[model samples]
Target chain A: MKIIACYSNKGGVGKTASSANLAHLMAQSGHKVLLCDLDPQGASSFYFRLKPAKKLSEDSFFTDQDKLLKAIKGSDYENLDVLPANMDFRDFDIFLSRLAKGHSALKKALKGVKKDYDIVLLDCPPTISMLSESVFSCANWVLVPVIPSTLSERTLEQLLDFFTQHKLEKSKILAFFSMVQVSKKLHLDTMQRLGEQHADLLLNTYIPFSSHIERMGVNRAPATDFAKATPAAQHYLDLWRELATRI
Target chain B: MPRLWHSQGEGDFTPLLSWLENKAVQRGLVLSQTEFLSGPLALIDNGDCQIAEQGKSLLRLSHKLLSISQRDIYPLHRKDQPPFDFPLPPRELCERIEQPPAWLLGLAPLRNLQILARGKGRYQQWRLTNRLHKTCGIIYLLDIELNGISAQHFCFCQTYRGFTKSEKLLTSWQRYIKDVFPGQTAGVSEIVALYRRHPLVVHHANTSMQKGRPDIASQTKRWLKPLLLAAFSNEQGIILDIDTEYLHQYRVNMRKARSLLSLCKGAFEENQQQHCANQLANWMQNTNVLRDLDVHLQDQVTYQQILPPHLHCQADKLRHNLQKERQIAQQRLSDQLQSTAYQTNKQILMQSIAQLNDGDKGQKPATQYGRKRLIRQLNKIFVLTGQLHDQSPDDELHRLRIALKKARYLAEFFQRPKTTKRLSVLASSLKQLTQDFGLFNDACVQQQALHGWLDSARAIKRPPSENIEALTLLLRYYQEQKRQTKYKISQHLRLLNDPNHQSALLAATQNLI
Candidate 1:
């Protein structure tokens, strides 16, 4: 099984939405996918209309296989399931510090579902902590959804510097422009500058800013399902196809 | 799991939809409907209903074959036409069928399926979704219209996996459906049963004679009519040359009919009875070469296994030649069966059977006649067994084998409800003896055929050394097989020679009669 982490240090970068949409598209392509809501906020779980998993303590999350499996809930679509997040996940970093193998704890926990799923998508929190470090260590690909802006560009550079300092494989990082507005000159300029600077890192497909994506909150479904004919959904499908070839 | 309900009412599904809508409203859920598959559904099975007997149904929807049970529906094959022979059905379908290779060799489509209707609006699916728009459960409604009869509908409800909240909703719906529809809680197997009830479907009828002093003539008719009809019914399958089993069963039924006629000596006029027996014998003789070729082709895998890898090519050549011969023989038999002369003969035989009456011994009670025949045949077998020796001729063994079969057939004809156990024991012993003889006979015949082929091949042209070697090895194998079977038959006869065992056999035969 391959693990893809939709991680970003900066919030409001459409990480959770991208993760939910990508997982849905992957499943629609006949892959058994599990969208793991590693965020304490449970935004991805909410988008699937699943309630937060109850009684899933941080300690049991990494050690107990049955408890982790029992916490997974089936989504409304076929071949897609969600491991809904619990409030206890806010202390995942704290709990991992107490473990003997803190760096590999998350990978070990994900091993339980190796045979059950073809793709385990981690909807990770926007933080650079011990838990994020474990995710970076174990994930096959770290998909960073970046808004086409100067601040997002600076954050991407910071993430790359951190990967360089920690000796992590920089090739594992794949960045894509999200919520891009073609009418804005600044967005276009920022994307052009970043695209040339990180020619090998940034994917070709981009998620355009659309009101249809915003309506996902009201529909409680992925954009691909509710707005299938829209360009935003098509872009997400194209993005998934590109990422699929890489992974 | 899906719950099914069958309704014999009109095809209107409005009542079900209304009830579902009300239930959805009460539970604060929305009910939605969509068009599912819509086409004529055809059910297919062989004469024996083997597929349905396994609690499954093979249904054709458009171009796909679906093997459906109570819990799951599997799409087995996708083709424009239904497959009716072995190896034509894909692996998915073959795996689902029991004893696929052997059983499927006899598979044929049932005739007179006019009960099936080609009606529109066949299937619809309804779903009940919660406030968050997640489907908790679904209901599939299938509409079946019988030709010249009222239309019926089957409703199946299935809950989504991992949706615990739908359990109570499913229960309430089940209860409501049962109360409203009243006696409609049947499953998918019922559909197969419905088709099997058609009168034109060929089935085996019990041929046991009547109880308590029945007249011999009526009892003979009762046993003889089904065998003749069943044999005649296989004519189409043989003419189509679909599989070897049709001819096999045809030969079997004719043999049984001949055996019964010979056993019941006085049921008809002497001349008429001899004519009927001769006709049956003639029909069997016409198919003898064809049946032998079919058997050899069926044993191709066994022949390959018996030879080494280097000889497989020679075996392949032999198989190809056998197949060519089989095609010719099958074509000949098919042409003959479809000929006017064959039909005229069949009509004459039927007329003779219809003219049968209570001739001299036919006025006797069937039980008495049956008992007398069984005891006489048993005594004849005993005498034959007594005359046997280590150096007995093949003709003597052949006579013994025929005598044993007649006795067994007589035993079956006279078997009473109360004497089942005793009859089974007698039948098993007879069966084992006949089976040993049958193997020995097959070996001898195969060896002769091989020798003839070898001589003909050498006379026609020079054959390869490998081909000659393979034929020699096969001949030797059958020779060894014949020897082994001879030894087994002798051992069985020696057991019969024990004085105590001989008296016990006589006693058992007497008691059974």
Candidate 2:
């Protein structure tokens, strides 16, 4: 089983949306996908209309296998499931500090579901914090969604720099262009510059900015499930295909 | 997903609706409402009841769509066509079942009583709440109605967040349903089995003749009667060209009856016995050409694999000619079955067998009679099988195979009451040996059929060279199979010709006397 983190140091870069959409598409492709809403805000869980269980506190999330298993909910779709994030997860970093060998605690916790899922997608919170360090140690692929802008480009470089400083393999950082607006000159220039500079790192497919994605909040489901024919859903489908091939 | 229940006694649905509405209202849930919809639906199974045996069921809804599940629905417009004929929708469902849609046998016609009434709208969705009223999971309900009555109900629940919440909610709902409807729970398989109509002429039937069943003639009559009836019942289906299995099964029953008659030697008057056997042989002969063609045509894939890609067009031509011949042969068989001579013969055989006197006290007890026939058949088979060697002619091996089959059939017909495990094992081994030998014989027969087709093709207007080439390739393929089958036959002979096996067989038959 492969653990993929749909992550970004910068917020509003389509991180949670990409995780939710990819998990849905992967399940549709006949993979048993588990979308883990690790973000404290739980926007990914909200998109799937799942409310986190209060019993799954920060302490039980990492140590208690049964509690973790109980936290997994079968989605309305076949073969897709979600481990909704608890509000108490805001203290995860603090909880991690209390544990020995905390760097691999997240991986050990997810190992319980490794046999059950073909792919476990992590919808991670934005920030280069202790949780991000744990995510870097655990995930097979850290799929960073970068909105093609100078600010997002700088964040991607910062993530890679952190990986390098920590002696983590930079190869795990799979940066992809997200929320792309081809009409904007700055967006186009940044994408071109980033594409040339990170030729091997960036995925071939770019997700175009579309209103259909924004309406996912209204639909409370993945764009692929509701607006399947829309361009935004098509881009996710392509991104999923590209990611699937790599994995 | 939870087990569905079929509710029987019911008043107007108004009270039940209000009760559910009130419950949803108490929970602060909004129930969706829509117009009621009703349509005829039939549950179908194959000839062998393959779907039912698989613990799955297919429902043809209103002759417009086929549904294996709520999501796995397929549009099936050709209601008259067999399930195998039309394209089945939900390709993924078909793949999961592992049987191609085309090979599905005996798609039953839509019966009027099988109609279903479905709710246009879903039941009110419920939120599983904690003590704090936070949403934990959601529960959905679906109702299936039959003949304007809400007969069945299915409920599905998924925790929006976690498995524990779902489990808790399911347990709570189970309690709620038990409170509402006392005890009417049924599983999907149980409901389907109760509703689906199985094909009448099933393949498996009780044809065992017990050893100590008083009179041999009466017991023999009892066994032959059903075999004959099964054959006659299948005739109409075969004549209408419903499916090839009907014809295949008809021949099987006829052959079994003939074998029983042959083994029972003096159980009837010599003249009556001879006439019945001859009549059966004639009936079998009438369909022999058609049956052979059916077997050959069904091996279309094997033929395709055997021939080169370029020879496919020729193979197609060959298949076309075989199909044309089959149509003619089928018509001929149909006419023969409907003829007065055929009708008279069948009636006379059934009547004579039905009324055969038990008073005709033959010299031997039924056990003795059976033992004698069994010993004689076994000895003949044993000697014949012994004569077979690597250098033996194909006809000799073919004769041995036939002899083995006759012996096996006679043994099965005269199976002893309380036969030992050893005897059964011996019988099983004999069957396996017979099948192995038969495969080899089929390869030879198939080769002959291909050669015959080629020879007959010369009489027709100049056949395509490619067609002839494909036939040659097919013949070669069969030749190769025949050679490989010889190795299989040798492997089977170790068990067939075992000294322990021979002694076991002799002991099993000798004890019956």
lDDT of each: 0.79, 0.71
Cα deviation in Å at residue B168, candidate 1?
Answer: 5.0
What is the docking quality class of candidate 2? Answer: acceptable
Tell me, by TM-score, which candidate is best.
Answer: 2
Q: Kindly give the stretch of ten consecutive residues in candidate 1 chain A with the minimal lDDT sum.
A: A70-79
TM-score of each candidate structure, all chains considered together:
0.62, 0.71
In Å, what is the interface RMSD of model 1? Answer: 4.0
Alpha-carbon deviation at B67 in model 2, angstroms: 4.8
| Residue B435 displacement (Å), model 1 | 2.5
DockQ winner: 2
Error of 2 at B237 (Å): 3.0
Each candidate's fnat, listed in order, reads: 0.18, 0.36
TM-score of model number 1? 0.62
- lDDT tens readout by residue for model 2, B1-513: 122222222222233445544554565543344223245445555444555555555554443334333222223334244333222323323443432354233243211111212222222334444443334454444344444334555554444435453354355555665567676544345545454333333445467765444466766777888888778867766776766777878898988888877777777776777777888888898888998888788787778777788988777877888899999999999898888988998888888877664434433466667777778887887777677788888998888777777777766766665666655665676688888886787787798998887787666788867767777789889989999998888777656577787777787678744
